[model samples]
Target: VERRIFTSKMWSLWRYGILLIIMVTPSHQQELSSQVLLDNISRIVDSRLAILDMRMNNIGSQLNDVANQDEKLMVRLSNNLEDKLAELEKKLLYNLEVKLSAIEEKFPNNLEERLSAIEDKLPTNLEEKLSAIEDKLPTNLEEKLSAIEDKLPTNLEEKLSAIEDKLPTNLEEKLSAIEDKLPTNLEEKLSAIEDKLPTNLEEKLSAIEDKLPTNLEENLSAIEDKLPTNLEEKLSAIEDKLPTNLEEKLSAIEDKLPTNLEENLSVIEEKLLSHMEENINQEDRIQGVNEMKMNIESMEENIIAAMNRSSVLLQKAGSTRCPEAEGFFMSSGLSRQCFKFFMDIERSWDSAVSKCLAEGLVLAEPYDPVMVKNYIATKYGMTGWTWINGRGSGSYITWQRSEGHIMSDIPYWYSGQPGSSTSSSHCLLLMTRQYHMKNYPTQAFYANTCTSKYYTLCELLME
Candidate 1:
């Protein structure tokens, strides 16, 4: 009875401890403590301990399997990453070699040869040409001016005399005859006749004299009325017969002859002498030619400096290290972004986007469309329609990557782009040189249906 009581007390304590463990342990793990206490409590405890040990062994083996699987997965992933890195490194090295060779070819080592070639292209007969021009120029401006002045007055007098001779000779003759026929002593003769006359005879003669004076006035008026009425008209007709553009010629001559002729002539002589001196001075001419040559050489040096700066910039930007194995090429201009053309692979807009994403790139978003066009022209020559990153309906377009609103003011679209059919056209397409056919500007944008299949253009962002 004492042994049984002692066993019962131990069992009760063990039950309480198990309950405490159950309360503290997680619900998933609490199922392991399911063995019940019996009258043979020692045997029951041993059996329960064996079952717990076996379950713990099973759990550890399962944990080991999971750890092995995880390690294998990590190892496979690492190997894949390493392979990709090695491939990328090889491609980069190959691309670098190719770029270095191209640079070497484009810009040779011997600058002296280039300088000599440039010198050969320069004009050699500059001094000779200048001398020939100087010889052809007028030297005796003063003598020429004086000669013109001397001939001017004589020509004018001769022309005036010829015009005077053209006037009527009968006019002068008529005037002289009228003067001769007029009575200079008519009043004196009349007075003498009046004195000789008797009183009645004198009165009658006075009346006759008054009547004769009235008759003489009427006769003079009649004679004046019978004279030439068209004298001014005849003179006008003679003036008209002189020349077709006679007045214009005279005005031009007047304009050519300066009002201050002597002062103008002296000024012209000074200017001519100065100009001749400048041209005739062989040393100065040679110096000017040398200066021009030096200027050209300086310009060449500036060009070379600019090229070196550009090369340095290219190195800094990593533009020369484009991923050529992936068919990517560097764009021209300051952006220096890399691009790839998948001409053979035609896909819908969505499919194209997927393809670009898979390649760790995005659809081409050509902010500088002109530079993009030039790059395409230089490398590809010509191409068919291709996909870009623009997507929208109507005038409200946006870049797929940046989601920035497309500015309509930019001249990136073709003549009739973003077409009227907005319902069907919701994606952007690049119009190529082949599509333009030299008619429209190449690489212009055009709206097309999202489902339409076209060549893809992908852009790899710069780090």
Candidate 2:
């Protein structure tokens, strides 16, 4: 049995992490940028506040001098003396505060809120804080703390205690212990580096891929050679394992063993593993993917995901679920809903409709107007048709038109045309006909205009 290492939880985690990371790190300047910018703003506010303090002191002295002056002289020399002085003092203080705030605004840190929260949670007692901190220290840091013991003065214990009292209660002791335990070695320092992902990981990965050794043409040939070589090794293994009725055993597996690969590798897995590295462990991914493909159960799971997103509503005619939106089935990362290949054809409607149903899709629906248009463009580029499910029921044509859309204006046959109920107008033809004296043709052309013969256009429904 082939080994399968990948689990669903691992897949879920990877997908969930990727989506969460997009929200957190978005646009690659990445998460730390806003925090760094916020820090700079706080730094600027500190500098501005320092300058304002000195200027405010100077203003205080000038205001005292103004107050001492006689009211008569003050009023004669200045207007609204009391109010003006108050206003000047208020403006100076307010302006100073605003500049300091400007710096605070630049920082991502809301220092006031964080400090308030920390204060509320801080441990009150010095002994408990100190004891807690000491308890969390690693054994190696015990020696380091002992070295600093004498440096801490007995009389200064209260000051150290005060600082500890202000420390956040939850991690205060642990953090102090961590600080004491920090390695003195230059190579080791407290850092969040392990938590940080490289900003250039993707680019670096791409760069590595570019640098990887791959032969221009010879590598493909080597890979092809390796395929049969692997087959030989597996055959040898079977030979070694078979019981001693060698002749009968060899005959039983001889024709079947080589073909087992097809059973082991699903078409999807085969497609996925077609891309593998040329290095020593390249077969690891190849085998894993190959095994995943082999599991029809997984493919069915993927198909369900495809079905969920499929627009082809399975109306158990009376069933109560309004169909899910059509575009979703093919949208999943692992599922591909449809593939179209245009065969060179010269056939009638009956044959075409049968051909489509055989492929497990209906005549192309006018849904996915854009995909239909492109498909038609590539297939005939100029034209295509879809069969309508209008027989026995009213005319509800859902053919793949040029743009996966039915033109808003239904074709009004020339005054005398489309009057025939039977054979003459049975077939729908994209052939040229005069409309209002101008030549008009449908995108999909059929040789005959007899409507009874069923023609097929691309229509998609769920598997």
Candidate 3:
């Protein structure tokens, strides 16, 4: 029985060794040919058999154990040793076959062919044989297998845990490196796009700018070309009217100037123009013209200031003084009496009245056209707007000289005169100046805004 067990163990070990040599040998090794693998397996099996034979010979050579022991005890001890060796051999062969079978299946190529060859070499009744051997196995087989099973799961768990820990750390480090690179790559891409966009936009904008002025000039030229003849004529007419308007304003300014300043300015202007037309020394003429222009400008400003003077001191016009007639006092028809109307300065309504009162004279109360004409005749050339004492009180018109004595008739009003509906038009003024055409008669009365500054009219009885 021990011999049969030993033979079976050696057969199993030989099969296991053949499978391991074929399956576990590296393909790159020079000694890895099929013949070499088979030779190696045979050598391993022969070596194991020789070791077992040597061990058996050593046991046999132990004559002292045989001589010292009783025959029965020696046979019993030999049986025990054989049983122990067989048990060990059985476990080793079973474990080797299992591990070698696993490795053999992992061979990627010629698996079917190799398995067929192995099957031809193997016993045909291998399963039946293994079943018979298992039935006769020791009762401790299950316990031994269970111990191996228990040791395998714990070792596998520890190995898996170690692998698991190392794998995640390496994976996390790689992922971190990848993540770090991503933002830099994205930022570089974005910066490149940002750099390109503005340059492209600037190029486009420059192209537009280059085209704009030409387009604008063309459009303007087209519009100008399309303008109607009447529009051009209208512009020409306005241009023609500019000089006339300017002359009229100058004439008005001249009228406002004092008589002496007006005469002096007129003489200087005429002389300058004559010198230019006669082709005088151009530099001298220019210098003279510039000097004269400065003088005229200064005089014009002074004259305007004098004409528009409203805040005047009345203490200079004394109470005992009387209006001078300039020897033209008339006590004849159309007037009870008339004295010279002299006004060199402008004043407000109150100031004008106070000034006249200081002169012991009254503001003229001309209610009819005959009185107005008579009064105007006293100063024939008196022109421009001037203030009279006619004022409105509630619904009644009254003169300052004859308060409460309302006038019976409205003599003459300029086109939109009186303007009595307006609160500002509370006083009366004589619009003596004409513009463009003479519409109103000379010294025509007009209702005016009271706040305006104007020359005052004073009257006194000629005795």
Candidate 4:
């Protein structure tokens, strides 16, 4: 029974060794002809068996050492060694099972299902689905734009004709009427005034010359004769009348003066100095007041001149009108500029600019983007992206058709806008859609690619 058990144990060990050898073999070697693969496996098995025989010989030597001891002690050592070998075999089997399970999980069980899923996600299938959805969308915007273009020209022509009828047809006749209202003898009246000016000035000068005295030298001589000549003799006579003890009298007056005279003099001097300072301050105040008056007068003159210029400008604005053309309208703001919105067609930034230039106009620049936004919203009810006359260089954006930089502080830009000039998108676009959750104003500016097509805005300045 022990020999049978030993044979079964050896068979199990041999099977495990063959399985391990097969698992560790290279894939290319395994793909060899069946007979060649079996030969390689047999050689590996023979080598492993030789090593096993050596290990068995070592075990026999260990057993011989145990044979010198008591029989019960030898049996106990043999059982312990069997138990350790069994534990190692179980551990090796567990590790092999774990590795096999991991490899099995890596590959899918159904190859057909995996291939079908990848095929469904291809580009051609996606394109077909997108085209079907696009066909269902409405064509309302195109119809509306077409209708507007068809009717715009006729309405504009009629309005222009009516305005032309109201304007003065004969400007020469009107000028002649104005000339008739002026005085006929205006030249003669100016000449008479000029004649009187020189004659009046000459007569006045001659009359003054005649009134002057001729004996001026004789009168001066007469006055000199009447004046006193003995001034020194008179002074000597007055000195003789002075008292003999005049110095003594002065000395007595000085002795009777107050003891604090020096102090009093100092106090009086300080008071005089303070009074002088006060006077100087008053003078400064007067001078400042005079200067302020002069400034006020100059300001008043400037204000008057500005008012006169503004009145003239207002009159000119009222008389002038924008050219009668389709798509052109006057600005609602004080600028009163003529603007045209080309909504029916789309063009690139450069192409749009060229079209405007060909038509004797320039691409519209929104110096006050808010005003332009409000005007478009109220007038045409338009809300879409369009190109303006703005371009960027580095961090700075400037109007392509006008002077001055487009300031970043202005609220015209959409959030996180005005991308770097070196980037592909550096041209300016007016975005009329709300892209973010925050409620930003419409017609906000966006940095966009120059090659992208969009509707254009053109400006016409009427002199």
lDDT of model 1, residue 416? 59
Residue-wise C-alpha lDDT for candidate 2, range 74-103, written one tens digit per residue: 676676777789999999999999999998
User: What stretches of model 2 exceed 4 Å from their correct place?
Assistant: 1-75, 79-82, 88-333, 338-340, 346-360, 363-460
Model 1 ranges off by over 4 Å: 1-316, 381-383, 420-425, 435-437
lDDT of 3 at 68: 64
- lDDT per prediction? 0.61, 0.41, 0.52, 0.58
Ranking by TM-score: 1, 4, 3, 2
Q: Report the lDDT tens digits of candidate 4 across residue range 295-321.
A: 432333233333333334344565778
Report the candidate with higher TM-score, 1 versus 3. 1
Off by over 4 Å in 3: 1-324, 327-332, 367-380, 404-409, 422-425, 434-438
lDDT of 1 by residue, 349-420 (tens): 999999999989899986556556655655576666778898884467778776665544334556555565
Query: Lowest summed lDDT over 10 consecutive residues: which window, candidate 1?
Result: 284-293
lDDT of 3 at 133: 57
Decoy 3 TM-score against native: 0.26
> Which ranges of candidate 4 are over 4 A from the true structure?
1-316, 377-383, 421-425, 433-438
| Residue 168 Cα positional deviation in candidate 1, in Å, after optimal superposition | 79
Q: Which residue pairs collide, candidate 4?
A: none
